[model samples]
Every structure is written in C-alpha cells, then in structure tokens.
Target chain A: MEVTINNIRKEFERFPALNDVSLKIASGELIALLGPSGSGKTTLLRLIAGLDFPTGGQIFFGDEDASHHSVQERNVGFVFQHYALFRHMTVAENIGFGLKVRPSSSRPPKSEIRRRVSDLLDMVQLGGLEKRYPNQLSGGQRQRVALARAMAIEPRILLLDEPFGALDAKVRKELRRWLREFHDRTGHTTVFVTHDQEEALELADRVVVMSQGKIEQVGSADDVYDRPGSPFVFSFIGESSHLPVEVKEKTVFFQGQPIGISEAAAGGGELFFRPEDISLVEAQDALFGKVTACRRLAGTRIAEIDIANDGHAPYHVEVEVPLHAPVALGSEVRFRPTRWKVFENA
Target chain B: MSDKARTSNPAFRDPADEGFATKVALLLLSLAFLIFFLFLPLLSVFVEAFREGWGAYYEALAEPDAAAAIRLTLLVAAIAVPLNLVFGLCASWAIAKFEFKGKAFLITLIDLPFSISPVISGLVYVLLFGSGSLLGPLLKSWGIEILFAVPGIVLATVFVTFPFVARELIPLMQDQGSGDEEAALSLGASGWQTFRFVTLPNIKWGLLYGVLLCNARAMGEFGAVSVVSGRIRGLTNTMPLHVEILYNEYNMVAAFAVASLLALLALVTLALKTLLELRFGAGNAGGRH
Candidate 1:
C-alpha cells in the first residue's frame, strides 16, 4: 500500500518531536528511516503505524485518510527491537493470534489457522519449532517468530523498529540479508527505522535521513552516499571531511590563495569530499597538509592531516593513500579532491 | 617493591570479603533478633491456643459465635479480594502502560491506605457512609445499610488491602512494558484481544501474587474493621474482632484459638508466596519477558 504523509507535526507538551514532516512511500517499496537517537525516526514510524497520532496533519493509506485510525484498524504489521512475542504462547499460537482474534464472521476456521501458522513457521524457517515458547528460542529465532506472527495478519504495510538492534553483529548481518529477501518474497510495502547507516544503505531501496525531527534528505543509496543534499547528510551518511574555504568568481580559495577548485556558489562555504575521493598531487597550488597520524584500515593506508589555516585554526581531514606510500607522522603531502561538493555557509 | 609488599601483607584480603568474625557476629545478631521478635511471638500464639488441649481447641472453633466470625471473615474476603484484584489490575495497567496527567498523584492516592492509620481509614469510610454523615442519610432514605454491617466490614477490609495488588503489579507490568501489547495491536488485534491474549498472560503470575497478599490482608484486618463494625456479635464481628472480644471477656482459650486461625491464614499466604517465587523465579514479579 502506498502511504502519503502530509505535513505531520507531533509534540510532547511543548517540545516538538516531528516538525511538519512529509513523505510519500510508494507501494511495495522498502524505505528506511535512518537517524541517530531522539531524531524522531521512531516517532515518525509510530505515526505511520497508527501507534501514535500526530499533533497536526494527515496520513493516507492508499486513497483512504487513516490519520485517526488505531493500529488494529490500520492492519499494519509491526516488529519491535526486542521481539515482543507473547512469552506464554507457543510459536504456533503466537503466529495464529491475529487470525484467531478476528471477528467471527471473517475469522478463519481452527484448522485453517493451524495450517496457516504452520506455513508461516515454514516460511520463516522455523518449521518444527511450533511448540517452543519465546524464551526457549534463541534471539534470532525469536525475532523470526515475531516476523511470522506479524505476517500472519497479512497486513497492507509492514513496519519494523530496529528489528535487529538487540542481536549480536553476526546475527544482525544475517537477519539484514534475510529480511531483504523476505521483503522481496512478500512484496509488502515495508518501512523500517534504523540508526546504522550501513544497514539502511544495504537493506533499503530508498533511505530517508532524518535529524532533529526533520527530514534532511530522501534518496536512493547512491544519491545519499555520493550526492548528499546537506552538510548534515554529508557528514552523517559516510566518512567525509569538510574544509572551510571561500569562493570568489567561481574559484575556491584557502589561505588567501585559490586552491585549484571551482564551484558555482560565491562567498565562504565548506567543501566536503570522501577520504578516498582525493589523490596525492605534485601541483604547487595543492594544499600540502602535515600528516599528524597514519593508520591501516582494511588494507588501505589512511593519513590524518592537519592544514595550517594561515591565522585561523587548522582543519583536520583524512586522506586515503597507497599502502606503500611514504605518508608518515610530521611529513607533509600535497593533495587535491578528485570530486567534491561545496555548501555555501548560511 | 610490589613483591616485598605482597609477601609482607599476608593478612590482607579482598575488600569485598567480610571477615569471618564480622560475618559470624552479623549472623548471630540477626538470628537472635528473628527468634525474639518473630518466631517467639508466632510460637506463642500456637502454644497458647493449644494449651487447653485439642478438644478445647476444636470446641472453641466450633462455637456458634466463632463459626459466625469465621464465615463473616471468609465472606468479606470473598467480596473484597476479587474487587481489589480487578481494581488493582486496571490501576496498575493504567499507571504502568500509559502516561497521563495526575499519574503521580493517582499513585500517591493508591498508597493512602498504607500511610494512614487503619483507624483513620475506617473512620473516613464511616464519615462517608455512617448514619450521621451526608451520604448516610441519603443511603438510609434509600433503605441501604452499609455502616456496622457486612458491607461496612468488607469496605474496611477492601480499603486496607487496596494497595497490595497494585503495588505488586506496577513494577512488574512496567518492566514487562507495552511492547507486547503494541505488537499485538499492530497485528490486527483489538484492545481487548491484545490485553486478553498478550497482557493478561504476561501478568498472570504477578496478579496471583498480588491476590494472595490482598486475601491475607482482607482476612486479618483489625484496626480498620474494628472501628466500623460496631462490634455487633455474629453480624459484623470478623475473626480478628472476635478474637479481641473473646480476650476482652477473658475467654483466653477461645481468643487464642481464633487468633491461631488468623495466624494460619498468614502462614498459608507466606507458603503460597514462597511456592510462587519458586515455581516462577522471583524475577517474575518484575516480569522480565
């Protein structure tokens, strides 16, 4: 189901949690609401699930305005970080709960419910653990049960809040791949909240980067990674460094000299580029920063350099170089960004 | 320097480890205190009750007024406990699962019965429903008898036992959280269905724990019931009040016999609580689900 969020604003007392946020999630697409803690990503997900109501605005499920609908009315499957499975119920019972609780007229037969539960258990790869209680299963197994339980309802949209947050790193990676495949198989309009940028980038078709209760940027993985729209996005999404420079006549200047970079914007601005996007240059006009430290990361040598800013504070940036390069502490290397974006300072 | 210091410091021990002498002293002190204050008094109740032999004990318990008091006590508990169980579940569910205005004030109000003297608790009810109070005349005009009757005794018992169930459940439910309930709702379960299938089962153990305590308090309540019961023989006197009346009349054997029944109830409560804690870990009270 397609979801349209129209100027949703939520407040707790006088503190605004989501500030007039708006977005449209297409049908059968996987979206990630990615942000740090307290960034309103979870709040926005809750609003979409109808677990919370916005202070002002509307949400439409397809063509229906469901702003005031309860979670039960919304028919959206939700999975929590802690896998909030009913501890007392067996796996089969948990999976069958939503079907069993339906109004009698629409409820499936007892045998049908059992068959469906069995099918769901099989689909989640827990085929014979039907009698196991939630506590009896491993963390990953319990989360799979939670997902199967959620899918039993056949919801129009699926929502997950840090579904893999409580698992160990290995299990989390496994679940991330499994969830992506699961989403493909089910083809449900899925939206998940996450703080891990890599998880968002890897698992989502589109990533919505949020900060301070507002949407910073919404785009595909490459769009967010290579072409961030804002400074926050640039610093938040990947390993990037920024240098404060002035732009005059479309030429970027540092320390009263043009540093061989040009931009459309005029006046002072910050230039942001990835560590691997720069290369060592022998040009005299290139910024030759003193290497303060060097370290090996995943077979690549990364040197932390500090450029003296004439009379102002020096700027620190990390530049990736060849493993055999002579980049050492206290040595100076001249480098220029191969590709960079300049954001005019406000 | 460290090797020499370590060799010389043979008497040194871990700071967390208590000295043998200190441990022995603490154990002895607590054991002595328990024997004097708790075990002795409890032992005395049984000793005094059975002093006149088992025949007299049976005779005392079988007396008309004694039987009446026992029945009344059971009846009051029967009515009060279930009422408090429902109220406690609702109150704790509200307090633990949701945020609202005046919540702290509501919690403090729930604890009011525990803080005030039981006599005051009973008096407050009397003031609300007694013959001379504002509602008393209105209730009388409607021919309802609450004060000095079974209802009054039940009310007093309910008042004193009100906080037990809610106190046991608030922390447990809070620890368990609303995650399960929200998950259920998002899976298309209605509010009632979510509570029935998810919330209720999660809290069942803690609920029973609370009910056990509430039952004990309702059966043994004295100070509050005493003031409101008017001490009417057979009609309003509970087991505890009957024991007091028997003692006041110098019916030592009967008083002790009745007192032993209340003691038995307390022991049963403790046994059941311990059994619950054993079957379901004590952490079940916190419900770490």
Candidate 2:
C-alpha cells in the first residue's frame, strides 16, 4: 500500500513532537525515517502504523482516510526495537499469533497457520527451533521471530521501529543485509525508523532525513548522502568536516584570503567537506593548519587538524590520510579542499 | 583468589565475614525472636483450642452460627477477590501503559486503602449508608438494606482488598512497558486479543500473587468487617467476629477452635506464597520479555 502522511502534527501537552510533517511512501518501497533521538521519526512511523493518531491533519492509505481507523483496521505489521516477542509462547506460536488473532470468519485454519509459521521460520533461517521460547533464543533469533510474526498477517504495510537498534555491531550488520534480502523477496511496503545514518543509508531505498520534528529532505541514498538539500541534511546524513569560511562577492576566502571561486556563488557560511576531500600540499594560498592529534587504523591514519580563523577562534576537523602522510604531532601543514559545500549560514 | 586474599587480609578482617561463633550467635538471636513473637503465640492458639479435647473443639465448629460464619467468610472472599482482581488489572493497565496528568495522584488514590485504618475504611461505607446520611432515607424507602447486611460486609472487604492485585501489577507492567501490546496492535490484533494474548501472559504471575493476597485479606479481615457486620449471629458475624463472641462469653475452647482455624488458613496461605516464591523467584514482575 502507498502511504501519504499529510501535514501531521502531534503534541504532547504543549510541546510538539511532530510539527507539520508530511511524506509520501510509494508501494513496495523500503524507506527509512532517519533522525536523531527525539526527532519524531518514531512518532511518524507510529502514526503510519495506526499505533497513534495525529493531533492535526490526516493519514491516507492510497485514497482512503486512515485518520480514524484503528490499528486493527489499518492492517499494519510493526516490529518493535526490543523484539517484543511474547515470552510465554514458543517461536512457532509467536509467528502464528497474527493469524490466530484474526476473527474466526477470516482467520486461517489451524493447519494452514501451522504450515505458514513453519514456512516463515524457514525464511528467517530458524526452521527447526519452533518449540523454543523467546528467552531461550539469541537476540538475533528473537528479532527474526518478531519479523516473522509481523509478516504472518500479510499486512498492508510493515513498520519497523529500529529493528536492529538493540543488537551488537556485528549482529546488527548481519541483520541489516538479511533484512534487505528479506524485503526484496517479500516486497512489503516498509518504513523503518533509525537514528544510525549508516544503517538508514545502507538498508533503505529512500531516506527521509528529519530534524527537530520536521522533514529536512527525502531522496535516494546517494541524493541525501551527496546533494543534501539543507545544512541540517548535510550535517546529519554523512560524515563531513566543517570549517568556518567567509564568502564575499566574487570569491570564497579562508582566513581573510581568497581560496576558491566556485564557492563564492553562495553567501557567507560554514564550508563542509568529507575527510577524503582534504589533501596536504605546499601551496601559499592553502589554509594553514597544525596536526593536533593522530590515530592509527588498519591502513590509514586519522588526523585532527586545528585550522585558525581570521578571528582568534579555530575549527578542529578530522581527516583520514594515507599512513605515509606527514602528519606527526604539532606538524604544520598547508591543505586545500577538493570538494566542499557552502551552507550559506554559519 | 581466596588464598591470596586471606593472606593479605590476615589482620584486615571484614567484620561481617563471621566465624562459627558469630554465625551461631546470629542464628540463636533470630530463633529466640521467632520463638517469642511468632511460634509461641501460634502454638498457644492450638494448645488452647484442644484444652477441652477434640469433642468440644469439633462441637464448636458444628454450631449453626459457626457454620454460618465460615460460609459468610468464604462467600465474601469469593465475591470480593474477583471484584478486586478486575479492578487491579484495569488500574494497572491505565497507570502502567498510558501517560496522563495526575497519574501519581491516581496511584496514591489506589493506595488509599493501604494507608487508611480498616475502621476508617468501614466507616466510609457507614457514612454513605447510615440512616441520617443522604440517600439513606431513599434506600430505606425502597426496602434496600446496605449497612448491617451482607452488602456492607462485602463492600468493606472489597475496599480493603482492592489494592492487592494492582500493587503487584503496576510496577511490573510499567517496567515491561507497552512494547508487546504495541507490537500486537500493529500486527492487526484487536485490543481485547492483544491483552489476552500478550499483556496478560506477561503479567500472569504478578496477577496470581495479587489474587492470592486479595483472597487472603478478604477471608481474614476483622477490623473493617466488624465495623459493618453488626454482629448478626448467623448472617453478618464472620469467623473473626465469631471467635470474639465465643471468647467474650467464656467459651475458651470454642473461641480458640475458631481462632485455630483462621491460624491454619493463614499458615496455608503463607506456605503457598512461599512455595510460589521459591518456584518463580518473583521473576519478570516487570515483564522482562
């Protein structure tokens, strides 16, 4: 089902959790609601799932008004961050819950429910563990069971609230790939909330960047990662280092001297570039910076550089350079950005 | 690790790490306290009950009034316990799952019965039902009796026992949170279905404990029941009131016989509770899963 969230506003007491947030989700599209904690990404997902109602505006499934529909009527499958598997029930029972809960008129027969549960168990790769309780299973197994349970109902839309939020790093990465494969095979119109930008970018077909309860940008992974629409999106979506710069009429200047011409089209703002964009060189016009700190990694070294501004302040930025680079402590270096964005505001 | 620590701490002893003498002294102290305060008093009740031998003890229980008292106590427990159980579940659901203004105030209100003297709890119903109060004349004119009747006794017992199940459930359900219920609802499960399948299973042990406590209090209640029972010989006089009546009339054996029965009921309740605690270890009262 295609979901349209129109001008939704949610208020708790006098504070707004979601303020005029709107987005459209295409059918069979895997989307990510990406934001920091308290940014209302989970709130928007909850509204879409019919777990909560908007204080203002409406939600539509295709052309039908879903504002007044109950969670049962909305026909959504939600996977919680903490798995939320029923502790008393075995894995097979957990997966069959949605089928069993249907009204008798529409509920699947017991044998059919059993077969479907087993089929789901195989899909999630936990086939023979049907009789095991949730507590007896590993966290990853429990989450897979939660997913299987949600899918049993064949819901109109599947909503996941940080599905891998509680897992360890290695397990989280494994589940991310598994979930993408699952989505591909199942073709469910899914929307998941996550604070981890990497997870959102890697798993979602479209990423909706949110900040302070407002949608900042909505685009494909590359679109949000590269051509961020606003400073918030640019700051939030990817790893970018920033330096305070001055932009005057025909040129962009760093430390009161012209540095580049292409960046002058935008007004004075903070210039942001990824660590890979900075290169050390012997140029007189380059921004002079001192290597303040260095960290060794597998094949590269990360250097924290402190670049002094025209004023007394300095901006500290991290750059990943080749391990052979001359980046010893207190070493002075001249550097220039190969690619950067001027956000037009400091 | 033990050898290293012991050598280093040859003179650096933790006072709490005791020798046999200290352990024995603490054990004897606790035993003495239990003997004087708990076991001796319980033993004395059994001894006094059999003072006139089993014939007279059995006769006391066989009396028409005594039989009526036992039946009334059982009936009140049956009525009061289930009513309180339902209230407890509802209260726990509301207080634990949903956030609202004045939730603390509502919780405090639920705890009111725990803090109020039992005499005051019964007095509240009396004030509402007594002849000089509002609605009293209207109820009297309608041929309805509340105070000095079964309804009054049931009401008092319900009031005193109402908090048991909720007290057990709220902390637990709150800790477990509405995560499972939300998961159910999102899976297209109805509200009733979600509660029955997810929320209820998670809180089953806590609910069982609450019901046990409510039933025990309902059956053993004396202060609040006495205030409303009005000492009606075969109707309102519950087991505790019967013991008081027999003892005051110098029927020592009869009084002790009834008291002994209540004591046995208390012992059985304690034993069952302890057994359950040993089995379940108060685990997941907060709905861990």
Candidate 3:
C-alpha cells in the first residue's frame, strides 16, 4: 500500500532520532533505508510499522490516517535482525500464527492454513522444513522462516530490519539474491533497513540514504551510485579520494600546479573523482606525483600516489592502471583527473 | 624417576612434599566445618524422623492436626504460588518492558520484602488487619477473622514470598526487551495474543523457575505464618507452625518428621534447579530471545 509520512519526528528524551523527515513509498515498490549506526533508519522503519509512534507527524496508509494506529491495526509484517522466531513453535506453527489469530469470521480453516503455510514454505524455499523448530534450523533457514511467517498474513507492507545482517558472508550474498527474486515474485511493498551500502544497492529498487537522523538522498541504485547528491552520499556510497582544488578563472589547480579541466566547466569548486576515473599519464599538463604503494585489485593495479608540489598540502591520490603496467613504488608518475564532479563545500 | 627428577618435575611431586600442607589443612578444615555445621544437622533430622521405623512416622502422619497442617500448607501454596505468578508476571512486565517515572522506586519496592525480615512482613500485615486497623472492623463485621485465621496465614506466606517470582523474572524479561513483541504486533497480533504467543513462550522457563521458588518459599514459610496464624491447632496452624508445636511439646520424633519433609522439599527444589540449568544451559537464563 502507499505510505505517506508527513513531517515525521521522533525523540528519545532530549535527543532527536528522526528530525521532521518525510517520504512517500509507492505501493509494490521495494525500498531500502540505508544509513550508518544511530542514523534513524531503523527508527523510521519502526515508525512506519507502528511499532513506534512518531513524536510529531501524520502517517497515511492509503488515505487512512495511521498515526495513532497500533501495530496490530497497521497490518504490517516485520522481520527482525536476529530473526525473532518463536522457539517454542515449529516452523509450520510459526508461519500459521497470523492466520490462527485472525478473527473467527475471517480465519482460514485448518486445512487451508496448513496449505498456505506449506505454500509459504515453498515460496521461501523451505518446503519440507515445517516440522523443524527455529533453534534446529540454520541461521539462514531461520531468517527464511521469519520471512515466511511475516508473509503468511499477506500484509500491506513488509518491514525488514537488517534481515540478512547476522548471516555469514556467503549466506548473506545468497540471501540478498534470494530476497531480490522473492520480492520480484511477490511484488509486495517492502522496505528493509541496512547499514551495508552494497546490499542496498544490489537489492533495493530505491535507496534512502540517512545520516544524523535526516534523509541525505533517495534515488535508484544507479542514480545514487553514479550521482551522489551530497558529500556524505559521495563518500558513503562509494570509495573516492577528495583532493583540494583551487579554481581561478575557470581553471582548476591541484598542488599549486595546473591540472587538466578542459571538460570541467565549474568556475570555483572542490573536485571529487573516483579512483577509477583518474588516468596515469607519462606526459605533463597533469598533476605531478610519486607512486607510494601499488596493490593488485581484480586484474587492475591500484597505485597510491603522493603529490609533491610546493605551497600545496601533500594529498594521496589513487590511480587504476593495467595489471601489466610498469608502475613501481617511489617512482615519479603524472596523473590527471578524467571524469570528475565539483561540489561547493560549505 | 629419580628423586631429583621428581623434585624438578612439579607435576610428579606430592602436594604435601610441595609444602601445600597449610592450604590442604585449611581446605579440610572448611570441608569439615561444612559437613558438621550443615550436612550433619540435616542428616540428624532425617535419622531421627525414621529412627522408630515407619511406625512412628505413620503415627505422626495420622494425626488430625498434622493432616490439617499439611493440607493448609498445600492450600496456601496453591493460593500463593498462582497469585504470585500472576502478580509477578504483571509486575515484571511493567518494570521490564515499560519506562516511566518512579520505575527505580517500584523495582526497589518489589525487592523490599526480600531484605525485610519475614516477621516484619507479617507485622505489616498484622498492623493492617488487626482489631484496631482500618479494615479490621469491616472484616469483623463480615465475620472474617483474618488476623488469627487461615486468611492470616495465607497473607503472611504471600507477603514473605512476594518477591520470589518477580525477582526471578525481572532481569530475564528485561533482557528480552520489546523486539519479539514488536514483531508480533507488526504481524497483526493483538496485545493478548502477542503476550500468549511470543512473549509468554520466551519467558516461560523463567516464569516456571519463579513459580517453583515462590511455591517453595510459600510452603516452608514459618516466621511470617507463626506471627499471624496464632499457632492454633487443626485450625490456623500450617506445616511449619505444626513442626514448632510438636517440638515444643517434646515430641522430637514428630517434629523431626515434619522438618524432614520440608528438608526434602528444599532438596527437591535444589535438584530441580540443577536439572533445569543442565538441560536448558545457564546462558538461557539471560533470555537472549
């Protein structure tokens, strides 16, 4: 269902967790709330789930004002980070909990509940494990069971708080792919919270980047990665080296030396470029530096260069060259920024 | 091995030869004290109870007063344990799951009876239910003799054992937090349903432990029961009061007999506690779920 959060704010005693933030999540769209620890992503998700109330805001679930609604009335499915499954119940019983608790008039029959549970187990790729308790299952299996249990009620929205965070690396990767496929097949409006940017980019159709209890940027995976709106997003979304650049009459200078800016039309701004965007050249008209360290990264040699120009602070720059390139440590190298973006630093 | 080699090898040396005699002596002394001060008295009680064979034991058990006392004690336990279980669950739920003003004071109040002497706890009830108290006239008007009756005995036992269950459950429930309940709530489970399905199952083991402890304390409560029960025969007297009466009447065999029952109950509680720890693991007590 469509969710509209208007001027939502949350506070813990004197500390504000969510600072008047607002966003709209269209129905059937999978979104990821991405942030570092204490960034209010989980708090926002909880507010949307009605597990917590916003200090000041109006939450609308398809024209129904859900600001004062309890979690039970919200009809939202939530998956916890640790997969808080009922240890006392078997997988089948856990999955069938929502159906069992439904009002008698709307409750499914025993056979239908069983069939639905089995169908959910199949959907989550846990077809034959209905008899197993949560403790008896593996971490990934327990997470999948949690997911299946959440989906049993056919909730209007699914909220996952770092669902695959507790799994090992291999299992995390596998679950990420599996979650993408599951979302595609189910087409349920889902919002998951995570601090891992890679998981957000790999899984979410839209990523909501949060910082300091505020939304920094929200966009598609490619939009966020290729065009970060803020410096925090630029640094948080991907790896990049930010070097101080002086703009004089539309000409950018690095380390007190003239740098190539023929393509950069910005008059005066700080230059930001990814390591892969910088090219190591043999000729001049580029910022001069000396190679300090070289490391092989996936068939590419990443050379760390330290600029050595007077009247300029020494800055470390990374350049990606071919694996067979003859780049040696402590050797003089000329580098030029290729694809770069300029931002006004406040 | 040569003597020099044995001396060089610390592992091969006798503890006595290694000059650990003082430590060994201290250890043995403490063990002897423990056996004499603790186990010996326990063993003596058991031996005295069964000394005249099962004949005297059966004779003591056949007494109407003894039967009444045992029944009253069980009745009190039945009333007290379940009441305390409900109270403990509610109190722990409030204290552990919710934050509000005076929370620290409420926690301290819950633990007050544990630190206060049982006699003082009984006195508090007596002060409330005695002839001159506020509710005394109303109770007397209704022909209720709570000060020196079965109700008084139950009240005292309940008072002294009030903290047992809640104390056991608070830390456990607190550590569990609101995560599972929140998950259940978001999944459309109502408050009672969430409690029954998610919250109760998570804390069931802890609740069981608390109930067991509360039951034990309620059954064996003597000081508080004696204060308020008035030590009447076959009327208000409980097991502990009956034991005291038999002992004072110079009926050592019967007195020890009743004491042995209580000791057995304590022993069973200890065993149950150990078995619970072994089966569930000590870490489970933290309520990680």
Candidate 4:
C-alpha cells in the first residue's frame, strides 16, 4: 500500500521531534530513513508503523486516513534494533505469534499456522532451529528470526528501526546483503531507519536523509551521494571537508582568489568537496597550500594540507595524493577542487 | 600464592583480600549466629510441637479456637495474595514500560507500606474506619463492620503484604524492559493478549516468587492483624493471634502447636521461594534477549 505522510509534526513536552515532515512511499518500494542520532528518522519510522502518533498531521494509507489507528489496527510489521523476540518462546512460536494472535474469525488454523511457521523458518535459512529459543541463536540468526516473525503477519508495510545496529562489524556487513535479498524477495513496502550510510545507500531503492528534525534530502542513492541538495547531506553521506568561502554573483571566492569552479550565489556559503576531488600542482601563483602531513589512511596515500586564507584563519583540507607524490610536510603546493558545492549560510 | 592455587579453588579471593585470620573469624561468627538464631529456633519448633506426643499435638491443634484461627488465616491469604498479585502486575507494567514525571514518587508511594510500621498501617485504617474518623458512621449505619472485624483483619493483612508482588516484579520487569511488549504490540497483539502471552511468561517465576512472599506475610502477620483483629475469640483471630492467646493462657502445648503450623508455613514458603530462585536465579531460564 502507498503511504502518504502529510504535514506531520510531533512534539515531546515542548520540544519538537519532527516538524512539518511529509513523505510519500510508493507501494512495494523499499526505502531507508538515514540520519544521525536525534534526527527524527526513527521517530518518523515509528509514526509510519503506528507505534507513535504525530501531534499534528495526517497519515494516509492508500487514500484512507490512518493517523489515529493503533498498532493493532494498522497491520504494519516493525523490527526493533534489538531483536526483541520473546525470550521464552521458541523460534517457531515467535514467528507464528502474529498469526496465532489474530481474531478467531480471521486466524489461520493450527496446521496452517505450523506450516507457515516452518516455511518462514526455511525462508530465513534456519529450517531445523524451530525449537531453539531466541537466546540460543546467534546475533545474526536472532535478527533473521525477528524479520521472519515480522513477516509472518504478511503486513502491507514493514518498518525496521536500526535493523542491523546491534551486530558485530563483520556480521553487520553480511546481514546487510542478506537483508537486501530478503527485501527483494518479500517485496513489502519497507521503510528501515539506519544511521549507517553504507547500509542505506546499498540497500534502499531510495534514501531519505534527515537532520535536526527535518528532511535534508530525499532521492536515489546516487543522486543523494553525488548531487546532495544540501551541505548536511554532502558531508553526512560521503567523506567531505568544508572551507569558508564567499559567493558573489554566481562566482565562488576563497581567500579573495577566484580559482575557477563557481555555481549559484549560495551567498557567503561554505565550500565542500570530497577528498579525492582535489589535485596537487606546483604552480607558484595558483591557490596555494602547505602540506602538514602525508600518511597512509586505510591503505590509501592521503595528504593533509593547510590552505592559506589570506588574512583569515587558515583552514585545513585532506586530499588523497599519489603514493609517490613528493607532497611532504611543509611543501608549498597549488591545488584546486575538481568538483565541489557551496551551500549558503550553512 | 601461585596462580594455580589461587584459581584452582572456587573460593578464590583476591590477593588484596582480608587476612586468613579475619576470614576464619568471620566464617565462625556467621556459623555460630546461624546455629543460635536460625537452626536452633527451627529445631525447637518441631521439638516442642511434638514434645508431649503426636496425640497431644493433634489435640492442641484440634481446639476450636486454633482450628478457627487456621481457617481465618487461610481465607485472608486466599483473598489478599491474588488481589495484590493483580495490583502488582498493573503497577509493574505502568512503572516499567512507560515514562512520565513523578514516576519515582509513585514507586516510592508503592514502597510506603513496606517502610511504615505494621502497627501504623493498621492504625491508619482504624482511624479512617473507626468511630472517630470520616467513614465510620456511614459504614456503621450501613451495617458494614470493618474495624475490629474480619474485614479489618483482611485489610491490615493486605496492606502489610501489598508491596511484595510489586517489589518483586518492578526490578525484574525493569530489567526485562518494554522491548518485548512493544514487539508484541507491533505483531498485532492486543494489550491484554500481549500481557497474557509475552509479559506474563517472562515474569512468571518472579510473579510466583512475589505471591509466595505475599502469602507468607499475609498468613503469618502478627503485629498488624493483632492490632485490627480485636482479639475476638473464634472469629477474627488468625493463627498468630491464636498462638499468642494460647501462650498467655499457659496452654504451652497448644501455643507451640499453633506456632508450629505458622513455622511450617514459613518453611514451605521458603522451600517454594528457593525452588523459584533455583529455576530463575541459576540463569537457566532464557532471559531477556
């Protein structure tokens, strides 16, 4: 079912957790709400799941207003950051919980419930572990069981909050791929909240980036990654550094020097560029910098440069240098950003 | 102290531990205190109850007042334990699962009964229900006797035993958290269904443990029940009150016999509580995930 969140605002005691947030989720499309902590991404996911209600807003499920529906009436599946499986229940029981708890008129029969539980076990790749309790399973297995349990109800939309947030690094990476495959197979209109940019970008069909109780940008992974609509998205989604720059008449000037790359007059905005977007040159009269440190980072040769900003505070920028480049400490080098963005008053 | 020797014994102490002499003295002192206070008192209860012979012991217990007291105690516990059990579940659910202001104050209020003296607990009810207080004449005109009646006795028992169930459940539920409850809600389970299937099972042993304590306290309550019971013979007097009356009457065998019953109840409560602790405290139950 398509979900439309219109003008949603949530306030807690006097502080707003979400402000005028609106989103439209197409049917059967998996999307990720990605942001830092306290960014209202989780709150939005909870609102969509009906676990929480917005203070002022209208939520529609396929043109039907559902803002006041309780979780039981919403028919949405939610996976918590922690697995939150019933510790005393076996895997099969946990998966069949939703089916068994349905109203008697709609509930499946015993045999059907058992068969579906077995099928779900098989789907999560833990076929014979039905008798094992949640505590008996490994972290990844517990998470898969959690997903299986959520999917048992055949909800119209599945909402996961920090789905892989509690796993080890290696296990998190492995399950990221597994979750993508699972999402593709199940094809539920899924919205999962995550602070992990890689997980959001790699898995979701669309990534909605949020910050400070507002939606920073919403687009495809490549769109948000390459052409970030805001400065927060640029620095948050990818490795980028910023320098104070002045924009005048659609031209960018740093340290009173116009070194070429210019776009909109984002007006006294900050310039941001990825580490790999700058190249070192030896030109004496170009935008000059002093190499502070040249070192290997994650097996890549990177140089830290301090750009001389005329009369202002000297700011630093990190750029990937060639492994054999002679950009040693105190070396005077000229550099220019290959691609950059300047967001005004950010 | 080689590492092998230090680690081999399960009674391993740190290198900066108390000296050997202090450990020995402390161990011996505790053992002596247990022998005198715990072991001896328990041994004497059985010995005295059976001292005059089993026939006499049965005769003492078969006395009308003793028998009536026994029935009264059982009835009071039967009413109090289940009522407090339900209250405890609600309190634990509200206190543990939700956040609001004055939460600490509410919890402290729940703990109020545990701290106030039993005499004060009974007195508060008496002041309210007795002739001097607000509801006294209204209750008397309606012929609903509470003070110096069985109702008064039950109320006192309930007050004294009130905190047991909630006390046991609060920490356990707090530790278990609202994660599973929220999960159940998301799984389309109604609030009552979630409690019945999810929250209840997770806290079953803890609840049982709480009820055990509440039942024991309600049955064996002396101070509060004595205050409110009015010492009415064959009517409001519980088992402990009967023991006191028998002892005062110089009916030593009868008093000890009734006391033996309460002692046995305590023992049974301890046994059940130990069983629950062994099951839950041994970390065998699959705890929160």
TM-score of 1: 0.95
If both were scored by lDDT, which would come out higher, candidate 1 or candidate 4? Answer: 1
Model 4 clash count equals 0
Worst 10 residues of 1 chain A by lDDT: A320-329
Per-residue alpha-carbon lDDT of candidate 3 for residues A239-296, written as tens digits (9 for 90 to 100): 7777777776677876566687743454555677788888777666787778889998
Off-target runs (Cα >4 Å) in candidate 2 are A309-313, B1-20, B282-289
What number of clashing residue pairs does each candidate have, in the order they appear? 0, 0, 0, 0
Global fold similarity of model 3 (TM-score): 0.89
- In CAPRI terms, model 3 is classed as acceptable
Candidate RMSDs in order = 3.1, 2.3, 4.2, 2.5
lDDT of 4 by residue, A101-189 (tens): 99999999999999999999999999999889888899999999999999999988999999999999999999999988888887789
Residue A2 miss distance in model 4 (angstroms): 1.3
Which ranges in model 1 have alpha carbons more than 4 Å from their true place?
A: A310-312, B1-14, B282-289
Residue-level error in angstroms, candidate 1, position A335: 1.5
Candidate 3 Cα outliers beyond 4 Å, as residue runs = A254-258, A262-269, A282-285, A308-314, B1-35, B131-144, B282-289
Give the higher-lDDT candidate: 2 or 3: 2
Residue-wise C-alpha lDDT for candidate 1, range A121-164, written one tens digit per residue: 99999999998877779899999999999899999999999988
On residues B72-172, what C-alpha lDDT tens digit does candidate 1 reach at each position? 99999999999999999999999999899999999999999999999998998899997778998898899888899888888889999999999999998
